[model samples]
Target chain A: MSMTMTAIVLGMTVVTYIPRMLPFVLLKGKELPSFWQSILQNVPYATLGALIFPSILTFHEDPSFALIGAAAAFLIAFTGANIIITVLGSIGILTVLSLFL
Target chain B: METTAAAQSEFKDGLAAGTGIAIGYVPAAITYGLLAKSAGLTFIETMSLSIFVFAGAAQYIALSLITIGTGIFEIVLTTFILNIRHFLMSAALSEKTEEEPIWKKAAYSFGVTDETFSVAAMKSGSIHSSFMAGLILISYSSWVLGSGLGYVAGNAMPPVVQESMGIALYAMFIGLLVPSLKTSLKAVLLAATAAILNCIFTYSGALSSGWAIIISTLIASISVEMAGRAREKGGIE
Candidate 1:
């Protein structure tokens, strides 16, 4: 890599590393308050919801196909089908739908 | 000798898993590479970003922001906001790593991607440094390899193929969500509320699709907690 690219890469690495490392350093060997801990427990659900919901619903120009695809994938996944199968099912459905619409 | 052996076994396990994750991530990372290249990044620049930035969504957002000539400060600020969840993930994993030395703990923490967190949390028995390290190494290597492939394969793919690859992310998300849906009503409610709020935000033009995720997730999570507390007091499920 060029010097400029190398420098940028290193800079980004440090910045990214700081965030990941901070909590481990600061929160280790400490007892968070119970209420805060409870709140923390919910963080994953919240973060995942935030990350997935918007993109699945309205981010696309026509979200219906994606929603249908998601619903199909969800149902299949819920039925204990493998993830690859579920995704393929959704993509298959979308491809078929595109043919019709 | 047994301890050393176990550690060796654990590191091998990590390397194996990292190899698997790298394989899974290749397609998506390739897509990112193509997008980055098409967005005017040189191959070196694109690969460097992947190696350093490492956060998938944030890297994509940064590329888009850069392409549109968003100010450096704004791009940095957005990257920071998007990555706020890493703080929570790191904290959760930190509690689970009580036995490791500080340096090992720090090294392992750097590899805490979303998939790694779920895998690590679900791991049985007391946390072993080697096992956790293996898990992280697997995930980190997968991410880097995927990014590299994406860079190399840039723009050679058909548009249809590119669009289809996005299904992988949605597929992965659904995989995560489906299991959780059965675990709790709070999970369902949280997901539904976020979906609704996301639609509202998108329609209102209040936030970009990415930022809407951060907003809706925060609101839905807080609401789920408050509602859960109220229900528990009232003996509601």
Candidate 2:
């Protein structure tokens, strides 16, 4: 890695660590208010949702291919397949579709 | 209170439990490694990212940011929002663990990824730092090693195959989101709100991609919560 990339890595490490460590350190003996806890619980789902939508559409040569992959992924995951299957299933579907496209 | 012997035993059990998660991480981590390599990250940079950052979504965003030549400020801010949920996970896990040295707590907190959090949270009874250490060690090592392996594998693949691998990241994201959407209407709305807001921001040239993501996430989360609260106040089911 170059000096700039290394710096970026270090910067990310700091930002990532602070959140992971801060609550464990600060809230060691206490509980968050229920509302805050609820919000926190919702954070992952909301964040993941935002990150995936729209962006996934632009990921392949044809938007349709990305959509097919997304559909495969959503179906596997929604059916409660493990993460491995959910991911590989999407890739598998996309690969097959790519042949025809 | 945990004796040294008991801590040792629990640590063994923790490793055993973590084996399940470690197995689960292999494909996901390898995919991350492959994608990182395809994004033009070096082996060391890719492996170090898994080692240091350890958050999947944040790392993915980092790759996207780097590929787009985003500013450092934007990269840092975008990752901060993506991983801030770890605060809740760590705080919740802390309640489940017995009091240990602040240093120990600090060390284990670094291992608190979304998957590990689910495992630790699902564990019954008070948690032991030694057990946490074992669990974290296995999962962390699996991720770092997997990244290295994936980078090597990506290097061996044909260019056409590698290019198609771009879909892997999007597929990974969809895989993550859909499971939760199955269980919650609130999740569907929050994600839709963020996606729409992000599109508007990006298309209007009002904000860079990083700020667009951060703003959309915050607004979506807050608005969804407020709407839920309003429904509660109005006695709507």
Candidate 3:
């Protein structure tokens, strides 16, 4: 890899690490408010939704393809399909759509 | 007296969880090692990134941006923004695990990942240090191993194939959303809201894709919280 690429990658490693590590360090043994506790409980769902939502809608040539695949994956998962199947099914459907479109 | 025993137990549980996560990580890390090498990253560079960044999505984003000749400043800014969710995750986990020593907390924090957070949160009882440590260790090992493997396998695959591998993270995210949807209507609403907001933002051209996520999340989360509160007040199920 180029020197610049290497540096960028390394730099990113540092930035990402700090954020992940800070709370464990700073908040250790510190009591947090109940409101903060409630908020924390809800944050993961919100954050994950935020992270995954855009991709499901926008990752394909026809946004509908992604939407359909996501819906299928969601249904399958909701119905208790194994995780591997859910992901593979979505990918398979998208790939097929890609081939056709 | 009981508290100390509980603390010890929590630490042990954390270690066990970390080990379990690490077992799965071995293959994935190998894949990552191959990817990095093909992307023109050297062994040491890839290792450093795996050791430090440890975030799959952000690292992949950084890699893509670098390959496309995005400026360093832009890349860094985008990554920082994309990873803002960690603040929320960490803050949440911290609340649950406020009994550990500072150094131990810091070490465990370093190992936080999406999988670790999920595993830890899903545990049935009060959060303990060992369980948290177990979860983190498993995830941390998987990540390091995956990156190492990706670097080694990097040269063997075509760029197209490597790019396709990028979907694994998205696939995992989908897996996460699906299971949760079965248990809670709130989760479904939050997810659907996020999707709608994401589509709106993408189409509006008002916000960049990265920022769009942050914006949509905030809006959707607030809406869900409000709607939930209203339901509770009305004595509705």
Candidate 4:
């Protein structure tokens, strides 16, 4: 890698590392107020939900098949499937849909 | 010796648990690689990205930024913004993790991608360093390896299949979200509200996807939390 590229890569690594490490490193053995804790706790679910939409629709050029994949995943997951089966089942559904399209 | 054995077993279980995430990562990382190849990144450039950065969405954003001839500073800033949510994830996980040295915490924290954080957050007990190591090893290697393979495979994969791979990660999100939604009304509301807000921010061109996620998550979480408090007071009244 060029020195420039190496610097960019290292820069990226440092920036990403700070966010992931600072909180974990600094917050140990400290108790957050319950209100803030609840907010933090809800963050994972909220983030997951936010991540799924809009992007899911844009997953393909045409979203109809993508919606099918999403639906299939929701149904499977609602039935208590693990992440792997849910992903594979939806992929399987999309593959069939793609075949027809 | 006994402690080493226990840590080994924990690590083994973590590896087993992270397998699902590793599978979900394959297609996305490969897609990133294929995109990187077309954008004119060399194999080393591409692998350096996956190896050093390790955040999928941020890396993709970086690739696009690089492709457009954006400066390194801008690209780095964009990555930092895109991945800012890791702060919350790390904070939440800190509560779950067994207290360890700062160095140990920093080491495993580096691997806390969105999916891994979700997995670790949802698990019932304290997170050990060895368990985190095992979980991250499988997921990280799979992502880096997939990107390399995609760069190598390069346009050989069918178009339909290439696009279909996009659905896998979203499907993983649905799979993760549904059970949480079912168990807690707050979770359902939180998820739905955040999704709606994200869609609004995205289509309206009001916010970047990264900002949209962070804002929507904070808004939905706070609103749901307040609503829960209100309901409890009403029940008492």
- Compare candidates 3 and 4 on TM-score and give the better one: 4
Arrange candidates, best DockQ first. Answer: 4, 2, 1, 3
List, residue by residue over B55-165, the lDDT tens digit for candidate 2.
877888889889999988888888887677677567667767797778888988899876666556645587888888888888888888877888887355554454455
Model 4, residue B161: distance off in Å is 3.1
Off-target runs (Cα >4 Å) in candidate 4 are B1-3
* Candidate 3 CAPRI level: acceptable
The iRMS of model 1 comes to 3.1
Clashing pairs in 1: B14-B134, B18-B138, B22-B142, B30-B150
Give the alpha carbon lDDT tens digit for every residue of B1-237 in model 3. Answer: 235777677767776544534543544566667666766766887787778778766777776776678887788777777666665577777777645467666766766776577556545566765666656766777788667766655355454433333344455566666677778988888777877887788778877765776677677777787777788889965
Which 10 residues in a row give candidate 3 chain B its minimum summed lDDT? B159-168
TM-score of chain A of each: 0.74, 0.74, 0.80, 0.94
Q: Interface RMSD (Å), each candidate?
A: 3.1, 4.4, 3.8, 1.2
The DockQ score of candidate 4 comes to 0.81
Please state the CAPRI-style docking class of candidate 1.
Answer: acceptable
Q: With candidate 1 superimposed using the best TM-score fit, by how many Å does residue B68's alpha carbon deviate from the native?
A: 4.0
Q: Tell me which of candidates 1 and 4 scores higher on TM-score.
A: 4
Expressed as tens digits, the lDDT of each residue in A1-101 for candidate 3 is: 56776667756766776777787777766667754555567666666676666665554456665567667667766777655566566656656655665
Backbone Cα, N, C clashes tallied per candidate: 4, 0, 40, 0
For candidate 1, please provide the TM-score of chain A on its own.
Answer: 0.74
Q: Which TM-score value belongs to model 2? A: 0.67
Q: In model 4 chain A, which range of ten residues has the least summed lDDT?
A: A1-10
Ranking of all candidate structures by their TM-score, best first: 4, 1, 3, 2
